[model samples]
Target: MASSATTGNPMPPSLSMPPSQFARLQPHAYLRAHLSPPSSDQPSVRANGRATSQFRVTSVNTGSLTHANGSAVVRIGDTTAVCGVRAELLHTSDISSWGVSQAPSKQNPTNTNEAKDSKSEDEDDQGQIQDLNLLVPNLSLSTGCAPGLTPGAPPSALAQSLSHQILSLLHTTNLVRADDLRIWYQPPNFDSEEFHNPGEGMEVDTEQSGGPEREIKAFWVLYIDIMILSMAGNAFDAAWASVLAALRDTKLPNAWWDDDNETILCSDDFAEAHRLTLRGLPIASSFCCFEGDAAAGWRANVIPDAEEQKKKKGSQQKWILADPDGYEEGLTQERACVVVDKENGKTIIVKMEKHGGWNVDSDDLRKLVDVSSQRWDDLKQALEQC
Candidate 1:
């Protein structure tokens, strides 16, 4: 007979150990050890050995997808996001009647009398409205990209929240002009139809009407779909960068009304397509704030000489990490996301969002702003080169 430990009913090593011992050896415990700081004297260094303020190497490529009207792939450190734009035509009659009217153009010079007449006509045509939902953006965060996501599951709350943020930034910052999507009715003979019936039917022949102005018949709706191929950190920054690149590469096909087919016809000539009017580039940067422990005098990684000053401290010290990775993000409790636009060499804050349990000092917030401005210049140059 053999001993029980070596018999056919032998158990695995984990099952042979006590429950308490097995619990302590869980994977969570091991991960925490690597992520958290061991002590105040020795701060935890980033896995990639990057400084607190330094960003990971970034790269961008455009026109990667042949099917898409415009496509781009952006990689920031380990995080990667791919964006594609699909342009579709929408007739004005199909849209809701409660849309906002388009603003008059200031590029063309008009006399006082003409301006007043145009304003009067615009007021009379109050039924016409412009669709604000032309640009639809969606983000898909799949399980293959990250560890936490489950396969075949619906979009998580985090993914939905990020999509909203990107859409809000696009609208609030005026990065893309709304007028660029409008498709006006360009008649073959403008002299003949200068003013016969200005605003009569949906398919009015402007050439026969003898009107000096062309009417808007249809417009382009851009669907921006973003996919995260990998998740390292800073998903927002990577997504926004991809959006900028895709929009820059977008070209709208030339469309005209077809009298025989009773539908709009698009020209096959790629060179005749027009480009979107991008007013300015708005770049976003994220920061994670690490709070120090009062009892242990444990300081964040960003603070300099924090260990030396442990002997002379009252309140807890906080450190700010720019472009934090997944490991750092998991340990941090506070975060700030800032979007800035550079206009004529001046930095303008497009939007700012801060959330956490800890209280942030005014001085620290100001420092974050200054850092974001500098990062914007770097990003702008990178985008221009791409």
Candidate 2:
């Protein structure tokens, strides 16, 4: 949420507070807008105090994808993503030198199956498999975030950025094990007539055994597609929470498949299929920064309003707000998102949302990490059900 004044008062120092308290406020001076007003769920004191540091409500539902090996739907505050992981059979005719398999013979039925399995697998694994990986992410802001759209409209920048971030995060973190994504290497990467090690090295034609043998390999690809059901700010954190939570509850079942080419030749009802194994869960946190006061957030445009509006020239600002709310987010300078993997014991500052916001110091980053670690238990318990 927006980082600014830790008070319930909406007025800024320039408008009401004395100059002496101004400097003391530092960044907090500009975050009044992020402070929630008194409400039934939150008492006035709790509304703008420690509770602000706390996250919005979060919920996770698993087994969302009937076809996917493992799937989850997570909703945190305003962010949500539906993550599904599917494992298919892969066949590889050209076995790596380090592969454990011994040379196959015509009498080997398993070898024969491998050859045919990979051949039967689909070649368009790239595109078809990718779509299966689409999962909702923390930053996903649905088209509904925009108050106006006459249908047949373009996606908002926020939505685009969210997709890129989610995919990049999963890719970089190796959340989906590429090796586990075994495609049945049926036809293999070649044909019988194709020459191998032609002249220079005097190659070998392994497929000459009437037909090439296929090898099956395991691969795990994660699809993270999130639809924004609401825009409660903190999309990054919300997405991260749901992803980790749902993954914990995910299961892979026994299913039929050809290991070669790593393609799903057919589908097996989940009841009888083996589920994907989840190693651990990773979470992300976001901080918002701004230049002017928090009150100016909506006016200047830092966060997405219930009604989306263009940001003011304030995209570039002098100061930074930490974890801004919708109001403070609009006025705040920029945002920083950090993801932490508890199982792997790693923390990554994903990207600096340098939208004219102030730069964060190492000390501030350390503080956020500490916060994420300490709160791990609570978040962990909340997601364990998923």
User: Best TM-score goes to which candidate?
Assistant: 1
Clashing pairs in 1: 193-207, 193-209, 193-210, 193-211, 194-210, 194-211, 195-210, 195-211, 196-209
Which residue runs of candidate 2 sit more than 4 Å off their true CA positions? Answer: 1-52, 64-69, 78-143, 146-150, 183-214, 217-222, 245-272, 290-323, 343-355
Over 1-386, each residue of candidate 1 has an lDDT whose tens digit, in order, gives 87767776766565376534643555334333333567867665544566567788889899999999899999999999999999988887786652344433422223434554534433332222113477789998968788978788989887898899888787766666555776666435534423345565345464345444445677678899999899888899999999999999998888887757767889999999888878688889999876555323234355667645654665645557889888667767778988888889998888888887444567777888888999998888887787
RMSD of each: 9.4, 14.4
lDDT of 2 by residue, 171-244 (tens): 44444333234443454434334455345544445545455565443334344445556555666666555555
Quote the lDDT for 322 in model 1.
Answer: 89
Taking all chains together, each candidate's TM-score versus the true structure is 0.73, 0.55
Top lDDT hit: 1
- For each candidate in the order shown, give its overall lDDT on alpha carbons: 0.73, 0.50
Consecutive 10-residue window with the lowest summed lDDT within model 2: 119-128
Cα lDDT, model 2, residue 130? 49
Model 1 ranges with Cα > 4 A deviation:
1-47, 98-131, 186-212, 294-313
